[model samples]
Target: MDFNLGTCFYILANYKGYRMSVEECEIELRDYDGEFLRRDVKTEGSIQPEHEVRENCKGCKRKIKLMDEGCVFGCCRVCCSGITKKISSFIGGKVRCCDVHNDRIIKKPTKSVKKPIKKEYVKRICIYKSLSQIIYTGHGADELLAGYGRHRTAYLKGGYKEVTKVLKNEVGRLWERNLGRDDRCISSGGKEARFIFLEDGFVEFIQSLDVTFIADFELGQGVGDKRILRRYAEELGLKECGNLVKRAMQFGSRIGKVVGGEKGDEEFEKSEKFKPPTTDPTKYDKDYRFDITLPDWLPYLQTHGYCVISSAVSSQNTNLALKSLITSLKLLHGNDVDTWDIPEHGLISETLGQSSGAWLIRGSSIVKSAFERIWEEKDLIVSMDCVIIWLSWLNNSNFKPRSEGLHLDQNPFNKLDMISVQGMIPLIDVTEEIGGLQIIPGSHVGVLKEEFKDMHGDMRGKGDWCQAKEEYVEGRGGEARLVECKAGDLILWDSRTVHGGKVGSLGGRREGVEDGEIARASVTVAMVPRAWASEEVLEERKEGFRIGATFNHSPHETGTSTGTVKGKLYEDYIPIELTAEQRELL
Candidate 1:
């Protein structure tokens, strides 16, 4: 073949080990500046190029590696060293050539010689090389294309409509369930991944297609799922690939077998790493009461099943009551105390209930006034049977008081005509952060009773006290609300309302002195109109007051008292003097 110098250079650079006969050729080589290095050379030869053609250096007559000096268009660098600017302008591309040295010229070319190419060109080549290292994942395809066995199950059960619904939900949550996790795993290796099926435009196109067209369950297995995609693959001559069966990545790689065992035999026991540390129940048993703006008590109570009366006892009276109780406790249990160690049901010693301190709290004119307003009746009798005291020490200890479960003080099987109400007086500010009482509002309006019956067998008249199921309290329209109060405030609830106590950390305290101080202190009391009680119940109430006995919350019942105080007795306990109004409670 007859060829010019440029054709010869191209053939020599690209087609290695090729032998061709060049009958005649006009050889012309130039510097980048177009200055002629050689012109109109004639040749006839059978040329067999072993590798790259090496040119002889004009200065030393030694053959050099092709473009080893970063020369432009294969020009001899030693002979044209001073023509860099001219050569650069002629090439019209960035060219960096090495400095020529007389001592470093190669006497004989070797196969190990490499060209010094421009850095920008090498960077471009590296970018193309990186493309080959990428991993392409078929992540979002399965979600959008009905590729799972579950999808086949859905199709069999409900046809295209079910499959379409499943696909929509899967695609909607793909980013949350799969894409994010897969991307994190792949990129953790300093590599990258691409999800071609998840591209926004491609996803939208697939979603726009009719479900029947996208998949055909009747076609069976491999051909049944992703029917449209398989057909398109076949059209592209990927017949074998198109016919391949689908396999989950975990199953295909056998990772599931190694990591989690057989599909149906996977064990999902709770991990100890996620278990919560055991908390000291006594640490949160302390009491709190804070003064807040009072709402209209009767109306609010009627609407919400409970209401808080701010300053139900005067601050001075509250402090006196607290001091009296503390003094009684000191007299009975000594001064250095960690907890009152009261009954878990929150019923304190009957002796403590009848102590001068308890009488002072029960006789507070403010408390009576609040109760009178609530019942709209002047003649009221207090439940002298049960004086519940929640007294906890500041020391962090595990002494839990009162079951946290919601319960009713009155039996639902009984007549609903009684107007009895229960109350609590906090000795410190009670806030959400320092948890206290929780109540379900409006739960006393007969609706909760029906729900309770549905959940538990009808136990009408079976018992007077019943703890509500947690599910009933947490279900729709049954969420409980916290009742926070300040010192001396009165929190009252209907006997039928669902309510419970919640212990909380006392939270902030001064560094040194207050660290082991009182964490929580509160008193529970209840009252009802005297007319609601029978003569026998009235006699029992009077006898209870005489013997310093404690009872539960019912003012009209005779047998509700916890009988005589059982544990630890104070023989010399003296009762506090009561006013005429307090005297009527007996």
Candidate 2:
């Protein structure tokens, strides 16, 4: 047998587990060869058992798949389903929120920190820009592999697991509403503008994944999930109501198609921008109050990028990035990990880009020093009332040097500044987590009540403003609307209008905070018309107030202030000061 015609089977075949005819065994061997070829397809470009294979992701050309000990090929490693399983197995902790973040952080000195550059030219456009949205699958990054929170919940509820579909839809919806907000705000020259929409909804064609949804949402349910969202709000100290739900506005508005469905109707009603709900403001009266502000000083503010408000429309991405920043900064501080600092001053960081209510007051310190001169001296020269009254007529953009603070002295670049009006400058940041200020609109132009009527002198956040709201602001606790803005957002309002920051709601934002918390953060400045000053001082103040609004102070609010000029002009001119009777006409 060894020499002559030894069958290829040899002798061990009779001893093997299965004893079959020679022909049958040949077929069985063919089957094994086929099986091997199938298993090897994932490793090699072709499934020939003899070819060499490489490690890579099956779906992508170059992305390497996450491999297990024995699985080195893309077939078993790169798919999201596999990735999700691995992540779940690794992290078994509880995630309490879908809308809130709680990582406090401190900013570490970057090896090379780039300063904000002063602009050479200012671009002004009308506030009639239309905004659009792009809705992509947040689920792919959001829910697919690891974040099966809602899907996981769906599995528990009715066993009809549609996690991927729901989230993809949700992401689309959020984009829609976000675009709406951008449209309305920027249409009024607020710098929250949009130019396009993008979407990805092909996932439904993939296998539907099932999981337990983590969020048991009972929205508009006064206090149910409110606490979860508020807990993070507490860390941040949100001044406005916690509309945490805006996170999904992009998905809701764009790719979900459901949001797409609603958008047609939303776009049809032009007047809906300012119309109030039939009910009251307190009672969840509407979807979102799209109060498009026609800045009282349209022509004046137009010299800078006043009308160019760009909403990132990537709110979730921006917020999560903030969480990461907060966490990373805290780690660097060597402080309690959960405790972080949020800069309550400096408002420029509110908006992520270089536009609108936020502007970089950085460059030559000489320029900064000059700017600070405007800061400490503004109110004394420009009657705060006159400045307030004039904001309605000017470009009403950043209004740098709106107010002074601790950091006012530390900005190594030019002295940074911020300004806001009764309404808020909301921003949707995509870069980091820290967000901007909040304010109550229409708090201005309203008179104080019987009780507060006696206290109408100095303060910005309290005193007479509170008294006015107690009586007039029906539904918003007082008679005022809040400006819930995102980062990179600069808010401007009438000076008489009452505004304040809700404690910091964004975690990683301010550099010093671990779990970000503080007052409404901003680099504030108020711009006043030269008319507010005495004729003698007006010449000097005019240089700073109206000049270079186009280039020197791009984001705006570069006001003129001469502390020395104030008292000196009052002395030399001897103009009759306005008494109560004379003030009424003004």
Question: Which number leads on TM-score?
Answer: 1
lDDT of 2 by residue, 1-586 (tens): 1111111111111111213454543443343232211122244233221112435434243444333212222222233233223223333422111011113121222222222111111011011112232312222333323233344344223333354456556655754654454444333332322232232343342224332222322211112232343444556877355433233422322222212223434545546566754522222211232111222223212121022121211233334433433343344333552233222223222111111112221111111212223343212221111111001101222211132210101111122123222222232321223323333332222232212233422223332222223333243334332344444333444333333333222233334432223223322333333333456454433432222111111122222311111110111221123333212211
Residue 439 alpha-carbon offset, candidate 1, angstroms = 0.5
Q: What is the C-alpha lDDT of each candidate?
A: 0.58, 0.27
Q: What is the lDDT of residue 342 in candidate 2?
A: 21
Give per-model CA RMSD: 32.2, 29.9
Q: Using lDDT, give the best candidate's number.
A: 1
Tens-place lDDT per residue, model 1, 365-412, is: 556656766677767877654344444433544444544477776666
- After superposing candidate 1 on the true structure, give the runs of residues whose Cα lies further than 4 Å from its correct spot: 1-295, 385-395, 400-404, 473-478, 505-517, 559-573
Candidate 1 residue-wise lDDT at 377: 72
TM-score for each model: 0.46, 0.24
